[model samples]
Target: MNLAELSQLDGPSSELLYNFGLQPVSNRFLSGNCQNSAPTFSLELRINRDSGLIHLGKAFPVDELKPRYSWLTCFEPEDHLDAMVKTIINLPGVDKDSVFGAYSFKDDSTLQRLDYLGYTKQWRIDPEQDLGISDPCANVETYQAVFTPTVAQQICQNHGAADVIIVRHVVEHANNLSGFLESIRALIKPNGYIVWELPDCERALEVGDCTTVWEEHVFYFTTFTFKLLLESAGFSIVHYESVPYPLENSIVAIVQEGKGQNNPNFSDSRIVQEEIDRAYRFVDTIKFRRHAIRNKLENFRENVGRIALFGAGHLSVAFLSTLGLCDLIDFVVDDNPNKKGTRMPVGNLAIKGSEALYSEKVRLCLLGINPRNQSKVIAKHSLFEEQGGQFASIFPGSEVYLEHIS
Candidate 1:
């Protein structure tokens, strides 16, 4: 569909910036021999003029779209979590005795770090177990579950209101942002604090990083938009930081309820124009890059023996499918054992272990993993390079990029 069609589809209050066509649900890793095609939906990014929120044009069903997460913070660098825990604990009225609660298993690493730093009283909300959920399709298994105000009330009733709620990387997946925030507020005590982390999209938008746009994340938040969103949701940002990492940087925010004020800057004409301008640039940059990358891969396929993409994360899925590079890739390599024998969504390419690089004789492997961890992966699979296999970045501007491809 064209721009005109999308604008009409989402209403005039929203401006359509980019359309990613039909993309398969990113995390639906299939069994290796599954012959059925993975389900897909139209992925489009648009900005709401009224709220200044950048979001998806269409909202997919929560149950079908909720991810079976393979991501764990323990596998990542500890510096970010170290800084985050230090920031929250240093806040007044927060101590080891203060209750800490999280929405899912994803927050276990952060809670463990908090415990290490003396905040030992931590509680995790298991929807099925704690909330008495019996249905298999309740969509509570993942962090993507939207905590309504009622759900929050029940949580507070079952296990007294938390002194601090740690919601890491879950807010962006929220289809109902306001409800999600209000629910979290309900779960926290009046004097409690909320510490949350999510991908900072400002850098990605400026550089037009296609990896930042995912089917799972309904909203793409810049620092400005994030603060505005929190304030609008009745929270005041007490502390904020952009934790630097590869691909997308994480936004860590410590906030308190009932302390928000309507910032005049939110409605500034200049700010609105600036957001629109960035959206335009993002569209142009992505369009140009997609064309260039597609051309490069077409030529590379003729010369290169076989191509495999490293990393089966959502970013890798977006990079391949959004840019239509799936057909060019022979298979995807991921270290996660759970994904090794599975299949990627759109392309249905077999997800293989790192050993596939040597066994399959993959001549060229594009790195779709985080740039920070790329060196470690390459070192672990050093034998692949020793056998004349080459590694290159799927996208340009990263530290580990192919001069020819970029």
Candidate 2:
């Protein structure tokens, strides 16, 4: 994003430019605040040109010890974290007070739920040591500061401060994982656990999905590469599990702060190379896929007229931008009531409630989201199916053009 555009953000601070470093694919826009009021400030996305990766410019981790309205806004990609935490706490001999949460601002609700799940006294670690001055845009006094990233500085600042730090959905945005992990090692209890969660690159390619590739995500991980990287930083993988099947495929990796003889399977060169091959292949075919999706939309327009999108999450933004598919859309439709009247993150479409889709007689609602949950989404929003709405498919084992509701 340019200086002029950066000047307009509701919350622009030195933290953004200091950590994000200014190159981007598009201008900033208001995205979801973890899909709710979240008291957590909403941050924007920026891309690194030299390396194709997504970076969440702002990093202000907040601990929601106090319950507030948490007004519903948009669905955060941080969904399913509640379940993940529940499972983590179930581990035997867990230290309640030592359970610290790091690397997020909007995940307070999920972290707060950990108390009920048997985790007590969770501390929200802010990686931004400096809050820097606010952007001169100066409109809303409440939303004027941008929190920047200083992983090493902040981690050192909190040296030996955490026994168990839970980092969820935050690592992929790191440009320097080794440095970040080293800082984290300094803060962690000598043998404390650092549970990490992120979307899987291998799965993204296997399914022909490229929407996960965005300006905000700089590094993608395979279980093995991540394990090797962590081990190199004097950390040991205690447990690792690849989520079998889900809308956005991901993995849960639990690591300890010391290096040891652990995880023999981390040396699989074959699977490691396979993951690399898949990522390269996805890059190779992205333009073609975008063209193919555009053609599919055009054919749909020829017969059905301008349509809308059913989601407004990060994946949706990435897909629309990557394929130049935003203009082809009339508007966006979402199940989240809080998102109504909001604009699409990367385009001009107004987000409307489910009722609006039917009122407009939307011929099709591009399920511009992860396809794993397509059946469940359609089933819940039966009006779309009963009213003869359709969706376009661009993933593996799926037909081209519009696919009817089955």
Candidate 3:
């Protein structure tokens, strides 16, 4: 029978039949109960339109009576759907409907979902790849490198060459900054240089970006604060550079390998006073922002039933903690498939997929995605509306609530 005629039988007899195109089937084998012996089960194969790479396979089993052999179509094979479809159709004496039910192209849309699971690429660190070595020959014989902390040591070993060892931004994350730096200093060669980079909170505050303060970053470094930190750890700044970037600012310092020295600019009494003053200013700014956020949340509650937060990254954790909105948010959603079904840091809220917003209970979706994907988010919002869901943004100036058309 033709393919269209065979499609009519949806019973067990027609299940195992499959069609094979111009490709060979030796590489693929049936993986169910009929492994060693042929038994009474068989399968068919056919070319699927959706994917040129994969062929559809169906499997069906038969029984032989004592007097005369009759095809006993038990049930559709459940074990190997793909292989069964490919095997049964190519076999002779097998009735098209009895062995192979019907064949259609396999759905390729699921491949996109697979790509979202981070299975598309294989990344490996090549030993020969350059590590941005600007001056490879600059005192190579005398310049021996050392790595501070255990993690940095592992990274150096992975690279296979240790020329320069730098620690910046890491101090803020250390439990004991003094001990951490001291350990690092022990690793440095006698005349080698140690470069440390840290975030300039003063510059970040100037831009009104308080989100820079995070759990991972416990210490905010300014020129004065960093100098004090280095001195405490038996190091003195030999050179310093403030490299300005559009986002959060940074300061790079070249520290010498020697004992700690006292800062001439600040005496013992003045140093204590300056640190106290900086602490008070930071607290005041945090209080003011918290007050502003409370007022905005009160207004937000008046219109929406519940808020669904998007993006479950570090920035979102900081925002939720600072604003004290952990209780206010209904749930958190993220585009990354791996993040789904996982709990968010700090708040411990379960991260869900975009489908969570489809529930009628969620009235507003508070977007916290990175600014780079803002346009893609806007386009997705339009698609969400087509499915009868409303859209809303909660950022300061770009806030908007869009009602969905039924």
Candidate 4:
């Protein structure tokens, strides 16, 4: 998995890699039939030269939408993250004082979550600088505003290897997952463990979630492919299970270094075709579904004016392009401090904090995200609902009220 380790592979090892169906991303490419009426978007899903991951194709115009921070902002959920943390905390034999590196917390949320969970305390972060015995160990449980790879590496190399490393939703953004995994292994003690939470690739198909395929995402994953990635990095799977629904379709795999095992059927050609077929089926129908949603929104617009969108996440962009409802939205409402005041990538509507809703006097707010949060959202903004505000969900099949007070 490490660059150095890759160079150490002998001819037979390399040949076995190919025979075992571990092909380099060099063969990864995109090929898909466009729906005659599919709205053009900068994002498209392509095969990763294997069955487990899907790569985003070239940018194309979709209802005047373009890409923004494909790799920067991954837009995941808070509760789901909390659950991942709970999973790690529940893992047996985790050393409390053992070094805990978040690896890629992306923001202070993970650090904050760990603290909130009564795990670790505040630790000042110094970038790429050595920390003495008294200094914070760059642990995921330590709170810090910003963490760069250099800072992370310093922590990885500092003192000794990490006892428990946690990486969440970061693999898809990685250009070289193999190298990253190897690098992580070197940072951990032989007895250390890693917990990785990734969005389930096949779950996207099962739930009819097309937004999962995008340029920012370098790959999608299923257990079969992920096992390949872990084993290739010389890690052994200790525990792996998908998080429950009403939550994102994700897996938290607890791993350690040892002989890696992969499913024999995953490498089969027929199996590969089946996986590709499932992916293509989703992509093919997405365009029509997007268009249909747009029409429905327009229909509702006939009755409701000055509508608002409930979430300013990636789904906001997906909704705008699919519904061409950017001009129709008043502002995108969200609780994330970072998102407020930013403009929706394509919608160009201002990202307003949830508090912004209290003063809007709006009648209807189209739920741009999964309707799952409808009740909580409405309760959180009681004034909005009390002022005769209502919500409509944007799920694929129909525009149902994921939650309605009436």
TM-score against native, each model:
0.88, 0.66, 0.49, 0.65
Candidate 2 Cα errors over 4 Å, as ranges? 1-114, 117-121, 126-160, 260-269, 335-339, 345-347, 369-377, 380-384, 392-406
Which candidate number would show the highest lDDT if scored against the true structure? 1
Error of 2 at 23 (Å): 10
lDDT of each: 0.76, 0.55, 0.43, 0.54
Index of the highest-TM-score prediction: 1
lDDT of 2: 0.55
Candidate 3 error regions (>4 Å): 1-163, 204-210, 232-236, 245-247, 258-264, 268-278, 345-348, 355-363, 369-406
What clash pairs does model 1 have? none
lDDT of 2 at 187: 53
lDDT of 3 by residue, 1-406 (tens): 2222212223222222122112211111122222242122222222212111111242121111111112211121122223322332222322222211000012122222223443232111121232222332211111112223553344335443222234434544443344456555544445444556556665544433435544334245656556655654456566665655433456666666555444333345465445445444544655666666556555666754566788766557656655566777777887666567766543456678887777535666766754445557768767565754555543332334222111
Clash number for every model?
A: 0, 14, 29, 3
Regions more than 4 Å wrong, model 4: 1-42, 58-98, 106-156, 260-265, 269-271, 322-324, 334-342, 351-363, 369-372, 380-389, 396-406
RMSD of each: 4.3, 9.7, 29.2, 10.2
lDDT of 4 by residue, 74-187 (tens): 345556677666766776666356556655435357667777777672232333443332222232212222333444566655545566776777666554445556555665
In angstroms, the error of model 2 at 192 is: 1.9
